[model samples]
Target: MKQSRLMSLVESVANVIVGYGVAVVTQILIFPVFGLHTTLAQNLKMGAIFTIVSIARSFALRRVFEAIRMRSAK
Candidate 1:
């Protein structure tokens, strides 16, 4: 079964949304241990930037793999 492009995008977005929350929380907890202090707003902003990049990377990789799968099915 092949996955549609829309589905791939939706999956990527959902995955990133979960990941973004995790990343922000982890940063809040872990940054102090590493002597890296940032405000909540800063953490949220950083997480948002990384989340955008992650979404793009995830979607691109999914597409690449889907293409490979389709090719090999021939």
Candidate 2:
């Protein structure tokens, strides 16, 4: 149980890191080529939005997995 909890924490942290990485990479590397202006404030707002979306997606995926597992058990 403890190991599982630790793994879950690691997964959550990894998601956050990946989310930030995507935000940074897109804003820094891709946006300019597309003629998009991403200032510091815009980056912060985008980061917050992406973080929320990522966490919600993780929870939604976890719930779907749990439901599938329960159905399989029966």
Could you estimate the TM-score for every candidate? Answer: 0.98, 0.70
The CA lDDT of each predicted structure is 0.99, 0.72
lDDT of 1: 0.99
In candidate 1, what are the lDDT values of residues 1-74, reduced to their tens digit? 99999999999999999999999999999999999999999999999999999999999999999999999999
Q: Superposing all C-alpha atoms, what RMSD in Å does each candidate have to the true structure? A: 0.5, 3.2
Residue range with the least summed lDDT across 10 consecutive positions in model 2: 1-10
Candidate 2 per-residue lDDT, tens place, 1-74, comes to 12243455568668887878788767877788999878877887888788878876776676667667768878
Stretches > 4 Å off in candidate 2: 1-10
Clashing pairs in 2: none
Best by lDDT: 1
